[model samples]
Target chain A: MLNTEALAGVRYRENDVRVFEELVRRYDRKLYNVALRLTGNPDEAKDLAQEALLRAYRGFSRFQLGTSFEKWLFRIASNLYIDRLRKQRNVRFESLDEPVPTASGQVEKALPDWSNNPEDVAEQNELADEIQAALQSLPINYRLAVILYDLEGFSYEEISGILRCSIGTVRSRIHRGRRLLREKLAPYVKPAAAAGARW
Target chain B: MTCEKAMSLMSAYLDKELGFDEFRQVELHLAYCEACSQEYESLKATKELLGTLRAADLPREFWPELRERLGAVAAEERVAPARAKFASSARQSSSRQPRWRGILRPASGGGGGSLFSSPMAKALVPAFLVLVLAALPMVWSTRRRPAEAQVSSRIDSIEPYFRDYVISEYDRPLSDKTSVGFVVTGQAVTMYTSDLLGPSSKVTRASGLREASPLPPNTAGNEYTLISYPR
Candidate 1:
């Protein structure tokens, strides 16, 4: 099988559509998942992923060979997502002072205590949803750092390149992002710790 | 290390991104400080919890739609350069001199004589003069407005000019803010916004023929208003 670099070289030199298609197929799942996590909407994720691929094809000539294709592709996707966010001005606002209408009575909105529940399949799904919500609550910069580092398993350096920032910025964002996540997921963390899970 | 410093390095310590001395300092602090240790543990648990969130599979329809779009883009790319070549050649054949030069020296034999004698130029000259005459008031009115208003309106009208350009954006995070720079390929213009999310002042230059100076810093905000137009 041809490596990504060879495939890219062929596509660039020969203008072979088949080579580009193969390249897209290889990264399609990863790109789509990243988009899904970023947008938190399936439809938007699909569109964003598709748009990123189209952009990659159009700008293929600018892509330098022998570099990590994944990073290059992700840079394009991240830019598109940020651009869309800027255009829409879609800042999510949740007031901490607002009272929640619970079944028993009105109470302050707070993170629920899930420390006692067993890690069953259903509970896991709910936990995933809660994690996703917590991620969405963060600022886009911090969210990108956390998702790329913790979820996507990209190294700090890789993230710095993909995000077009220095390693110090990456460190600051990940540290602040995790701190915020810890605060939000404190209830879940205690239980996982009690269950003897190592970080 | 102070607790504040230890807490700040907790994430890096857990991720092992810290250097030897820094890592040792953090480790030594965590060994003695119960509060910092617990904080570190909590951060570690948070990262672990994130690991449990499974990656969802790409939907079946994604590839099909993407393939269709790629096909359309390919077709358009094939046709675009030929069309541009024809247009350029037609323009060259019509008049090699600049418009202003032709207007100033109509009797000059160097591409100006044939241009003024052409039937198309004969009709276009009257229409051009009429447009300039009609636009005089509007131009005067626009110039009379505040310079800031003119800049805002120019930024708003930038979308139409970008139709033929391919835009690639680079976002650089400043110490406390984000600045976005847009590189437009296929055209000689480049635009820079000092702030990404606020009412930013952008600098746009079109091939060095015309350049708009950046607006005053006080009037600029961090949010940029994107101008959208239908293709």
Candidate 2:
């Protein structure tokens, strides 16, 4: 269980070390899941999650008393993942202005489209690898936005706080991130499957 | 709304982030435009696909390793401040001021006061001072100065081994010439010197060793002396 009081009392030492350990353990599963989705590898995810937790513990002094611990932890995980990507990003060049290829073997300036119905996609019958590959294909920021919103079920406001951006920017990132992800997952999804999703 | 504009907002529309007027605009537009409607549907589908990526269980051994690493981190954070504080307080004790004063000492030289200064820096400075004082005992322990018993008479001017002791302990460079001078006035021992630069040599107050030995009664207030240790 997450010892909220112990975390709140981070400045105080009377709280047993076991309490802090329990606090980290409580959020381990969630952070691991979010990290796994972001990195697409279990080993990398584990490393990212551990680093995020360690950073959070060190920086606990700045954390306010009443704020959401989960969101704070998520911000650390997301930022670490983004920071790692940024270091490696300079090695290769990818211009978002350039056209992205579509499932139809065509090229366009904007994100591509998925032929499958939204209902069918949400049904959860596909292999995990298909979704993992699609997520990894997205640019780091876009991948984070989508993962935070859909995978972690964070509110736009919470994501804005985590990413340290305006709500409008969060909305735009989530929108664009989902669009690109849909384009990537289009091939894995089936068309003409009784499109239950309407605009 | 036009197809391009409506499609741009389709993502927000699916997210229900649109306000009343914008939502109405998107709703009215999506009611008629099949392309915009299809885009919104597919966009939602892509985001939903992420929900299916399940979290895998970590190996049992990983937890123990992580816990051990965390313990190490905790120990470091705990020891760092305490070490710096104790060293700083000890250093402050050697000075004429009461040891308690060091704890309440102003962190900044300016009138900004200690309250506004960094708590961490304030805590560590005194601890660092303590390490500086350790040179006196270290010299005796290492037997660097065989006649070290007489070194403690004038605690202020630790000439022979202060610089070497500090450099050895801190493992850092020091100024070429470290000249510290002291004058005993009644019960108050006043140590005064400013960026006094001279060639490295054993120097006393009057000429060389004049001020170092007992001062002559005739020497007036105008006469200032320094103890200079050769580097």
Candidate 3:
């Protein structure tokens, strides 16, 4: 069972390591989901999610009581992801920790890497890959708004705070982003359906 | 409402961001308008398709690894003076001003003076002072330097009028020529030599070379100094 109060209590510890672990256990999945949608790389998303959690833990004393912990956590994740993207200046998803494995089972030497894990379920894998490819094809701003709203289920207001845009602008970006995504998925989606896949 | 108008606002309406009257209008139109309804459904379907794109989960080992890395970092942070250094600076800053301004307020009022009245106003005062103190020298220099083009234009216009005049020759007994200097007394003594000296470094005219010397008592002897200094 998830007890946010207990988690909050743990997070409030001056420097208690166990409390931080519990905090990590609580939001790791959700943050990972949001990061994956934003970045569209499993390894980068994992690292980014971890980074967000670690940052939150470091600054946990600032967390407001009686408000949505999830929202606060989400804000941290979204901000970190946006900052990382800005710093990279058009580069995407090359993890410092893990690299693409080559023929000799050694990591490939490259700047911005695009690699897929072979272990995921095939249909889920296809959906994930197509989603990533389609996401990358969209403009970065549109991609951020759409991912924050539809996939991660952030409200327009929350997304505005996270993306630092007016609610009206956030709505329009999500709408336009969805339109472009639908057009991009049309070809890939129809072929998959024709092969008897439901998604 | 027409399909275009309804379609245009469907995104806002779906997001529940429409103003009350706009929302009502959309609801009323959607009750009877099949075309608009179909368009809304299509847009809704598009959103659903988008929702299928999920963030990939990290491996089971990933969090543990991150925890280890962060633990090491936290341990290092514990021993390092970086936090202490920041805290000391923060203490000095806070001591210099009030502390309540750091707290979050619902409405940070636009009446600028009210910000200082804030409980945290003391802290903000020091921070603000620090910023101003840091900026003062830069601001002073920026204000002190005359605009280059304006000075250049003034020089260009003033130069031609006086370029022809010169002391024909300093012919006299050395004592008489030395005694020929005037002793003009006024607040401003040393003038810009460039005003009289042409760009070629020749003293073409000395119109404002005081009829009487304004030279102070310490340097009352030599009066032939016409050095050009930059503005």
Candidate maximizing TM-score: 1
The model with the greater lDDT, 1 or 2, is 1
True contacts kept of each: 0.65, 0.40, 0.32
lDDT of 2 by residue, B75-124 (tens): 88788889999999987767768766665666556646554257787788
Tell me the deviation in Å of residue B169 in model 1. 99
Recovered native contacts, candidate 2: 0.40
Which should have the higher DockQ, number 1 or number 3?
1
CAPRI level of candidate 1:
acceptable
Predicted structure 3, TM vs. truth: 0.51
Identify the candidate with maximal DockQ: 1
List chain B TM-scores, each candidate: 0.41, 0.39, 0.31
Chain A TM-score across all models, in listed order? 0.75, 0.72, 0.67
Q: Which segments of model 1 are wrong by more than 4 Å?
A: A1-15, A90-124, A191-199, B90-231
lDDT of 1 at A133: 84
Off by over 4 Å in 3: A1-15, A61-67, A90-124, A188-199, B1-4, B15-20, B31-35, B81-231
* Per-residue accuracy of model 3 over B66-182 as CA lDDT, tens digit each: 878777766765666667888899989877765555443334666554444566876887898999999999999788557644544565554433332113222223322221221
Task: DockQ for every model, please.
Answer: 0.32, 0.25, 0.15
